[model samples]
Target: MTNDRRVIVHPDKPALASSVAARFLTKVVDLLDERPVVHIVLTGGSIANAVLEQVAQSSARDTIDWQRIHLWWGDERWVPLGDAERNEGQAHAALIDAIDIPEANVHAMPASDGGLTLDEAAEAYARELALHAPEGADTPVFDITFLGVGPDGHIASLFPHRSGIQVTDATVIPVRNSPKPPPERLSLTRPVLNASDRIWLVLAGADKASALGLALAGASRDEVPVAGIKGRRRTVFFVDREAAAEVPERLISPDY
Candidate 1:
């Protein structure tokens, strides 16, 4: 881990969600002021959705020009569009639909319903990313990437001991039989996720304590995907007290 890594512990889940949401909005506002366009990669999970919901409910949602912001997902279930298992579906109901962002700016991975096989879907997503990426790059330089740390120490669809976690050359890859349910998913590779300027990993509950501990302890990337998660500038773990139980006090930041 880098010296820039920070662990922020909140009193509880609600507090954690609220703080992350506020930070997200403020950061995006600042990015908008500094650049013409900003791209963010979002993750899916209970805590992640809670944060998005908080953003939708806040009056600060109107502070930025959503039209200039582009949103992408860190990973997505390879299910039909509108399926409850789809991350994009959960995201739309939680925040996207409530925001004023344009349809063209929302870069979602291809869905199974789009008549593409899992491999084809992954290829299509890579192509989409390349369109916005810099010259000679396969993926875009994401501004901020929001990721959820699984209790199993997985991030995106890259689970422990999985071949997907070992891949660094691809922009996106198809994950078959993921340790978690729905089996199939399309995930951006670590190279792509790590390309971001800031990485915010969110987690809650006592169930995640063990994984959080392992990750911060410098667990091998092949065994703990979260251990390899980092950004170009800053990497932060936004965890609730329950999930912070095993996180060393030394890594915990004093305040927001």
Candidate 2:
């Protein structure tokens, strides 16, 4: 099936979260219909986690074959296991904790607990993917990667002007001195993000207006790492009206 990148703008946070959660449910349902198992890469942050919370509240959550679904992280703060700031903890608090998905199927990036350095964690994640993903695939495995754009145009740990944007080999890498707090992180590189089957970038709030403007203006990927993402399957942007207001009004919605 040919997939088209879609842009949906909602009026409020609740509306945006519900809409995104519904779409996620639909996508997972479709994938499950096609195959027994679905592999998804999850993102962290208030907006992305809100989507998961909304999904948990939705009636459709029960329809998903949670057991057959596999989950991975797009990036993670390099903190000890169970750190409140950790993406794994955020996800668990929002949805995973409520769901019946097998613990073994949830592939969280390495935490500091395993005597693994950040680089070692990245390599370990790559090995895990190699073991689970199909042979000859573009990069390990991921049916979809959910991304959240920082106000400064960062995605995952590939912050603007960071060297992780240039990574080509390993799908995941350790990042140091990140612009945001908790300086250290592990992130999926641009090459890996570009290789994903689908990418859904969720943006909301008024603070993101300026960055959205720069991205739509055809900013260089190296300058705005979020803009660097190009997926082979499909790419989509889900933004609130406030966040997308700066985009050319004409491109805001084709239906308009």
Candidate 3:
């Protein structure tokens, strides 16, 4: 794997969502030609949800085998199963609900109402990940990992300057007293996220311009978490023009 990095700038939020969604579908179709199963780590954010909605509506979605695609979250708020604030819930409404995938294929993190404490849920998800791990690996090899970058440069639940950002001992880490809402969350550690074959980091808005610039400029991982992510094969920053303010013209790729 080359560990290649690229910047894809779209015209606006809608363009970013639709382009990424179409790319996702085509990638899945191509992967199915090489393997029987494909695991994708998904993230949450308005832009991410928009992309999922695009995936749901695109007729091109029917080109791949839905059952072979396993959806995993990069991080999840420890809210109840169907809570409106839960990432899984948003994903369900945006894409999963309209698809014919099996319940077993959707690997959602535990809910607070599921009788498991936050720590318990984290450990349980870790065990589940290990169960699906390849023979010599501790975590499953994700084919494509979709992540949404926060305006502050956070990826998943790993906020800048947070202690959780340094944790590599666990595949899934429990985040507490988070700067973002809901306070508690379960997130796949950076190693897991970085281990994916392809990483798609997306952002949309002027608020994200600073973070996006720092990330592409190779800022400190502790200060800008998104900067640390590097996929085994390809790592791409998919941003709308508003968020691409500081991106170098040379890095602005015209196509994938």
Q: What is the TM-score of each candidate against the true structure?
A: 0.98, 0.94, 0.98
Q: Which pairs clash (backbone N, Cα, C closer than 3 Å) in model 2?
A: none
lDDT of 2 at 168: 88
Error of model 3, residue 42, in angstroms: 0.9
lDDT of 3 by residue, 1-256 (tens): 5657899999999999999999999999999999989999988989999999999999997787999999899999988888998999999999999999999999999999999999999999999898888998988899999998888899999999998778888899889999999999999999898889999988899999999899888899999999888999999999899999999888889783
Off by over 4 Å in 2: 1-5, 254-256
lDDT accuracy of residue 101 in candidate 2: 94
Please state the error at residue 98 of candidate 2 in Å: 0.8
Write the candidate numbers in order of decreasing lDDT: 3, 1, 2
> Model 1: runs farther than 4 Å from truth?
1-3
Q: Where is model 3 more than 4 Å wrong at Cα?
A: 1-3
List the pairs of residues colliding in candidate 3.
none
Candidate 1: residue 8 lDDT (0-100): 96
How many Å off is the CA of 196 in candidate 2? 1.5
Per-candidate clashes, comma-separated: 0, 0, 0
Relative to the true structure, candidate 3 reaches a TM of: 0.98
